[model samples]
Target: PLAIQQTISVYLIAYAAMSIVHGPLSDAIGRRSVILGGMLVFTLASVGCALATDLPTLLAFRAVQGLSAGAGQIVGRAAIRDLFHGDDAQRLMSQVAMIFGIAPAIAPLVGGWILGWAEWPVIFWFLTAFSGLLLLATWSWFPETHPPDRRVPLAMRSLVRDYVAIFLNPRFQRLAAASSFNFAGMFLYIASAPVLVMQHLHLGERDFGWLFIPTIGGMVVGAYLSGRAAGRMSGDALTRIGFVVGGIGALIHVAYAALADPFAIPWAVLPLFLTGVGVALIFPILTLAILDMYPRQRGSASSLQAFTSLVVAALVSGAMSPWLSHSTLYLALGSASLTLLGWAFWRWERNVCQRLPACPQETTAVEPADPL
Candidate 1:
């Protein structure tokens, strides 16, 4: 168990750190090339992982795999921002999230089945083939989103300057905080899943789906609704609604943990469903807001955004979760606390937006544009 935890956290740590590099590199070069190169690296690393006979070898390949994992997600976010604005962007983000949501719901089931027929190395082999196929598809079809005219030069001086500029911006920090901490609220539960299922709910390893399936289902629903709401609701309004819904879910979970002795299924996991809905609702809007902050530096901006969230998740998984996993109430309180932190950041961003002269004054919902 400890080895598994260590290996998982290490992958995430490597991923978080490398996100900072991949985003800027994509900005300096082009999205398609960076993505293609990353995919190639990932595919090869997956093969290495499959062939590894020792733990250290496996871990090294895992780290290599993590290094390439951020490329697609970061570049894809940049592409959406590059192609569209406002509601068009929101709808596209929601749609993408909805499609992507299927993987988490199905992955554990697939893994369990794989273990039934073969050893764990087969999992890596499956990943290798999947990534290889994706590489080919991307190579063939993925157009260059970042044009030559818009490309930033890759230089150490400029890299430091850009990173510093992003970090120093109070508004950027506030917005990023809102997105990252909100995710942390749900991630606390995810990080503590072993305790949640085994100790609290008295379930076996395969029962992860009990918690994940409904949660992911809710996310898909929320993403669909968010896509539909694009032209009808202002981003601020949608964000506020999401926070309120998430707060309610967090409170419900906390209250149940306070009262219920042995947490019951369906009921115990229900709050997670609501929280997932809130997550999908707010994610696209917050993500786009951060990217929009530095339109010219969208890749860099996406990098910072991914780095912040990944780092926060890593800490929560490695530090906060172990401490809080002792009891259901503690876990619930931890999640609630994170949610409140996110809400506070949102409030601060709202105030900052009101005052900043250059801040977009999006009083009305944006009208939908033709899907490109």
Candidate 2:
């Protein structure tokens, strides 16, 4: 999908399409039930993905998988917010981030290994089994975090209104849009890296997994650091630091990509990992930023931010893959370098033009951030 770039649009489509319904549903059903259901569906869909023989079929199944996959990504943080207070929320999110941080780095390598030794079907089988485990974990260990008394009524009209209300908020839009662009930069990497690993660098499927380790490693480091230190620094300051680190990594990646001969493997790949570091730095801050903007509708706020990222990712992946077919450097470097410039613009807006928002209240209700 990343190689040809055509199939990835399907992945993005599935991702984006699912976001619209999942959050509202989570709000209606308890978070525990909604998340678990999604996991089961996600597991079966993973199996379908493993069974897929061609792009179209894989895509078809991915749509189902995408729908199922929305829960964990969407509800995970909301679950945390439901349970904790402000610093506590960041702390829990950080811890969860630390734990969840393992997925991106480990999953690909594990999948690559499974694909190499067995058929791709086995990968889906693993996912199926993994989902079952998640279901069991949720059932046995997790409780109803979102109490029935506190649950919001779900309605089509209300859902639409909720979505509109989010986009309508200027503060929400800025933070959400900024995070979406940042994620698009990272997703551009996800969609393009497979080809960059396999085709450009002459790696096999298993090697592709191994290649993911460094980038994920950077992500883990960034997330851990951000989580630990978020208390000492303003969230805004912390977020900017992430963008700067990420930007530096992106620039280095661009430089290496431009100078490389055929495909040096380590050359641009190292910088690519650095870009991952940048993403790691930015992800939590973006989430928290949007949360501050619209705390009451956290599920909606998270959903919108997630939806935006997935949508932006799909569009970016679809657009850049065709153009950057021959040049991995051009693709990765181009998108990320541009995101860096955007971060600069956003930072200026936050600092100078926009009124700095006050520290967000710890309550779960939707409220203004500080102010702009």
Q: Which candidate gets the maximum lDDT versus the true structure?
A: 1
**CA lDDT of every candidate:** 0.83, 0.68
RMSD of each: 5.4, 4.5
Candidate 2 structure quality by residue, lDDT tens digits, 80-143 = 7778765667666766654555565576678667867786678778888988898889879888
Worst 10 residues of 2 by lDDT: 363-372
Clashes of each: 0, 7
lDDT of 1 by residue, 1-372 (tens): 776766686688789989999888888789999999999999999999999988898889899998998898888899988888778999999877665544545566567668778988999999999999999999899999899988877777677777877877777788889989998888888778778888889987778877777678778888988999998878888888888988999999999999997788988889988888888888888888877777777888889888998888888988999999998999999999998999899899887775322376332221112222
**Which regions in candidate 1 have their CA more than 4 angstroms from the true location?**
99-106, 354-372
Clashing pairs in 1: none
